[model samples]
Target: MSYIKAGTDVNGNDVKLHYIDQGQGSPIVLIHGWPATYEMWEYQLAELPKHGHRVIAYTRRGFGNSSKTWEGNDYDTLADDLNAVLETLDLQDVTLVGFSMGGGEVARYMSRYNGARVSKVAFVSAVTPFLLKTDDNPDGADKSVFDDMVDGIRKDRFDFLQSFGKKFFGVGVISHPVSQATLDWMQSICQLASPRATEQCVYAFAATDFRQDLATLKVPTLVIHGSSDDTVPAKVSGERMTQYVSHAQFVEYSGAPHGLFVTEKERLNRDILAFAAGGTVEGTADRY
Candidate 1:
């Protein structure tokens, strides 16, 4: 039930972010993807601590137990919320990990804050560089795709989430990476978020360009993406990220989906542990 005040909303009411701080060592801040709470890092929270790394994950302003605010769902405010966590905890030499939409926070935070308090970063199935396809960014997803997402949310939020969760974890008739109960649990977590925040964040992650922000990453970086990710294609985000941060170590989870955090948790944990410890990650370069 620990909380950190992330400024205030339009009504000047304090926007408190519920967070989980556990373990003790060099810190790792875990940012959950869209439509999820800090609870999404349940596996990491348990495993990372066993390895002696302090892990912190927080619910975003409009999600979970955090204050449901009408504003501040943008990347700028989201990055500031991350800053609040780092500052409040007085963490140093940290490894910041962002997944899916959470990756935008890591990218924006580095650029906006000049990489303060962090020595390394990792993007797992992230939405970065840019997601919305423009005339200049032909490799990005078409705007209509995101438009449909927003429309779906508006028309039937819960139904959309139920469907989205399946695609997220690569759960289909022939391929069930996660159980039905797991999907149910995830949907429950998504329901904890404010509908306004959920809808607004779609626009944020869809349209926000992080190309300039990627240029600001001077720290050690790791990029992991599933080759089968349909949510945020690696070709668009993770693959393009290495072009920006040329020194980043990239790993492609062969046949993995966007929800590799769950489907490939053991491998993901190993890679993260290796990278955080400054050890060589056992993987080949991008093989596409």
Candidate 2:
């Protein structure tokens, strides 16, 4: 087990990012989502190396070790933070692995800037194109839902994360009957994030529209989603996301939920490695 190394974002804030660097060959950067940290990728860190890939997972600003700033909670700032991390480490030819909200950041950054540094991309249970249901996005969660969520965050960020965490899992119960350990770990990691920062990020995600961003993804892309996901339903966000990305492949896991990257880590890692290895991937794997 490796310890997280400390670092800072482009803004030069005292941001701490936990990372597990393993193996050597191609570099793969794993970006996690809200209410979760780099620790969410523990299973992938341990397994991806055997496939001849260097896997890196880090907590985003306002989550886990990274510094929590009241400012820069929007997607553009988040993308700049990622750029700073990659550039600071002098990493190149990277395969960006983004899960949930992390997917939004990746797509936004790739849309704005594309170079040899980013080779390919992957989205696991992501929120893209757009999350909030506007007049145009009628199928998405209503704006009121996001408003209520933000309201809950303002009322009490901790409890808000706890309740939000429940929605992240398929079985919408607070007790977490399916995977209590994962749930507990998620809560603990979230506790490390700045409550104010998390709350601000909620606004950023709920408002930002990534449809144009997805249209700009020109590199090889992999879109993975859980068929049964309630948070970001496959039929709604993930499916539509694939349609927008020019060179994207879609993979749907039936019966899987939003937390497949956790519950189904092994299978997720397998598919990611195979795709990163330049092989064709089409079909579902085991559900964790």
Candidate 3:
């Protein structure tokens, strides 16, 4: 129930960000994905602490219990908000982990603040490097893909989320990675977010390019993505991250999907714990 003041909104009102700060040794700050609050890290929050690590997860402004401001949805402001949390808490030698859209914040923070207070970073099923396809960025997804997302959200947010949730966890005809109840719960959490922020963030993650930010990473890095991630494909995001961050350990989860955080929670937790402890990460050789 802890909260941090993340600057002020356009109307000069204070914008408070709700965060969960727990556990006691080496800090690990988690930034959640799009349309999700800090609650998404339910398993990690419970597990990481028992292993002697402090886990801090916060709800991005306009999501969950945080302030619902109409602006500051872009990466620059989002990174600043992240900076506020790190500086306010005065955390040091930290492990910053970003999931899905949260990865963009991790990448931007490195470039924006030069990796202050961070020693290690992990990108789990993140949307990083870049996402929109241009003539030069051929591997990027088509602009139309993002366009449709915006249109869908604007048209019918709940309906779009319901459909998107299925694809997020790789829920197919025969393959049910997550139960229907889990999907329903996720949708309920997503529905708590401000509709304006939800729609605006779609453009932020889709259009913002993090290639330069990725190059600025100097700390130990880990890139983990699913091989069958249809949301943010491995080829365009995680696979390409290794090119910029030459020393990063890349691990591809075979047959996993975008929501690997939930679908592969145990494996994901183990890998993150190993990396945080400066130990050898499992499946580093299984790069796809």
Candidate 4:
């Protein structure tokens, strides 16, 4: 990683985009989810470069070291902000990857904007197709659950985020190999995020229906899910997304939780590289 060059968006409001540019092949733009910064993909930057692919991961507004925005925080605005970042950098022949809420960002882009610069798409533990249960989506979580989440945010966002962090790992109260230091680091990152923006994002995640948007995607897409993900279950969210995405490949990680990116980074990274490098590989859950 080198000193990040600053860039401005269409709003002329300095949108702090930090990047680690390496390798000399097609670019891979990584979009992270709620309460996480570009640092989440730190595991990828060093490796992907050695593999001959450019990896660009940046902090979205109101997260990490990026400029905090209290203005509008919605999916459309978030998508436009990303578009600005991509356009300003003049990135082409790119592979867009998104995880969790980041997946919502990817789906929104594919649906609204013409993917002129993007060649491939990957969704790792993405929330898409639909997250809220309605007349059409009986499988989704009840609307009240989202409403309760919003209420929790309203009461005490900091504690809410802290508690949410535990559920994010889905390991429950039991212990894991990942040290307390690592867990604290992740929690600190989530805690640093602006509560106002993060709360709005919760609504964005719960309310927005990406089914229609996903149906419009023609680009080669990979949908990766963990079987034991409690935050956003594989069957309801990811599995449903595949039905909408034309020609999308599905991969399931057995007993892998939502934090598969962190818990199973090596295998996830390998899968991503193989798919992007024009190599044939299986998409099912197999221990690396």
* Best prediction by lDDT: 3
Q: Which regions of candidate 1 are displaced past 4 Å?
A: 284-288
Query: Judged by lDDT against the true structure, how good is candidate 3?
Result: 0.93
lDDT of 2 at 1: 38
Query: lDDT of model 4 at residue 279?
Result: 62
| Number of the candidate with higher TM-score, 3 or 4 | 3
Q: Please write out the lDDT profile of model 1 over residues 1-288, one tens digit for every residue.
A: 799998888898999999999999989999999999999888888899889899899998999999999888899999999999999989999999999999999999999999999999999999988999899999888889988998999999999999999999998889999999999999999999999999999999999999999998999899999999988888998888877888888899999999899999999999998999998888847432
lDDT of 2 by residue, 157-271 (tens): 7787777677777756343435667767778888887877777877787789989888777788888998888777887777887558756788888778888887677779888
Q: What is candidate 3's CA lDDT for residue 281? A: 92
Q: Is candidate 1 or candidate 3 better by lDDT?
A: 3
TM-score of each: 0.98, 0.89, 0.98, 0.90
- In candidate 3, which residue ranges exceed 4 Å CA deviation? 286-288
Better of 1 and 4 by lDDT: 1
Per-residue C-alpha lDDT of model 4 across residues 244-287, encoded as one tens digit per residue: 87578888887788878788778888988987875644765322
Question: What's the true lDDT of residue 131 in model 2?
Answer: 81
Q: Summarize candidate 3's per-residue lDDT along 133-156 as a digit string, tens digits.
A: 988788888888888998999999
lDDT-based ranking, best first? 3, 1, 4, 2
**Per the 3 Å backbone cut-off, how many clashing residue pairs does candidate 4 have?**
0
**Model 4 poorest 10 in a row by lDDT:** 1-10
